[model samples]
Target: MSDTAAERAYRNCVRNLLAQFIHAVQQQPPFILDECDEESLHYLEQLESLPGTTGNEYAELGQAVVCRTIAAFPHLVPLLPRDLLWHFGGDCLHYMPDDEIDKFQQLDERLHQAIGEARPFDYERERAAIFGLH
Candidate 1:
C-alpha cells in the first residue's frame, strides 16, 4: 500500500484495538497490555498526546483519538453493553464522592439544565453520566 493508505490502515487498526482494550479496562478494571504491535503503540502515543495539548485543541484531539480508536476497534462497540462505560471511566479517574449524595444531586440538576441547553458535557460530567446520560 501507499504511505497514506498504510498509515490510514494502521490508524484504523490501532483505534479498534485500543477501543477494545479501553472497554476491557473499564469493565474489568486494571486490564493488562501484555503486548501491542509497534503501530498500535505509535498510535497510542498520538492518542494519549491529546491530554497534554493546550486549549480546545485538546478536546478536538480527544475526539479524533476516540473516533480513530472506535474505527479501528469495532469490538469495543459490543463491550459497551450500556452507558456504564462513563461510570467506569470516572471511577478510573478517581471521581469518588466529595461531600455527600446531596452534592451529586445538585450537580445532577445543574447538569440536566446545562444538557438541556445543548452545552456539551465537560470530561467530568461525561465520565459521571456515561450510562446515566444516554
Candidate 2:
C-alpha cells in the first residue's frame, strides 16, 4: 500500500481497538474528538503541557486529561497517533462526576500516577504504559 493508504488503514484499526477498550470499561465519554472546537483542543493542549506538582495542578490536569480522553474517546475513530490521543486526554478530576471518576482512575493505574504526580508529564511513557491495555 502507498504510505497514505497504509496510514489511513492503521488509524482505522487503532480507532477500533481503542474504542472497543473504552466500551469494555463502560465509562462516559467526554466529547466527540472530531466535533470538538479549536477552543476545546487548545484547552486540552494547555492541560497536557501544564506543570505538575503545584497546588491543585495534579488533580486539575488529571481530570482534564481523563474527561477529555473519554469524551473524545471517539477520536480513535480517526485512529489519531497514540501520543496525540493521550496528549489531548490530559487533565484533572473536576469535570466528570465523582463516582465515575474513581472508576476511570481504577481502570488505568498509570492514570493515577500521571495525575497524582507533582511534576511535568511524560506522554511517551504514558503511551507505552496504556498501549499495553489496548
Candidate 3:
C-alpha cells in the first residue's frame, strides 16, 4: 500500500530525531557512560549503528531508545527530542500529557490535509506554531 501523509511525516521526523539524538549523545561527557545499564548501553550501540537504516528500522530503534531511556536513564530523557515520542506513538505516548498528544494529533491532521491539497507544509514550522515555540 502507498504510504499516508502521516506515515511519511513520521518517517521523516524519526530520521531527523535519530540524527539529533546521536549528536546529543556524542556531546555527552564520558561520565554519563557510567550511568547506563547494560540494556541502555546496548540500545545506544544499536542507535550508533543506524546509518543507512530503513524507515521501519529507524522507527523501531527510535521507539527502543526512547523506552530504554525512560526505563534506565530517566535523568537523560530530556536529551531525546520530544517529537520522537509523538511520532513513534506507543508506549512513547505514555510520556506525553493528553494536551500535548492532542496538539500532535492536530499537527498530523494538518500535515495530511496540506499534503492532500498539494499545499506546502513545513513540519517544524507547523510544530513550533502549534506548541507556541518561538
Ordered from best to worst TM-score, the candidate numbers read: 3, 1, 2
| TM per candidate | 0.36, 0.27, 0.77
How would you encode candidate 3's per-residue C-alpha lDDT over 8-109 as one tens digit per residue? Answer: 665676678878887787666432666756655676687687756667886787677678777866666788888878877878999999999999999989
The lDDT values for all models are 0.45, 0.44, 0.75
Model 1 quality (TM-score): 0.36
Q: Per model, state how many residue pairs clash.
A: 6, 21, 0
lDDT of 2 at 10: 39
Stretches of model 1 off by over 4 angstroms after superposition: 1-35, 77-109, 112-134
Global fold similarity of model 2 (TM-score): 0.27
**Whole-model lDDT, model 3:** 0.75
Candidate 2: Cα lDDT at 114: 42
Better of 1 and 3 by lDDT: 3
Q: What stretches of model 3 exceed 4 Å from their correct place?
A: 1-14, 29-40
Tens digits of per-residue lDDT, candidate 1, 1-134, equal 22343334433443554455554534431123555566566656665464357556754555555555456655544553222222223332222344433445454565565555655444344435543554
Superposed model 2: Cα runs more than 4 Å off: 1-37, 76-134
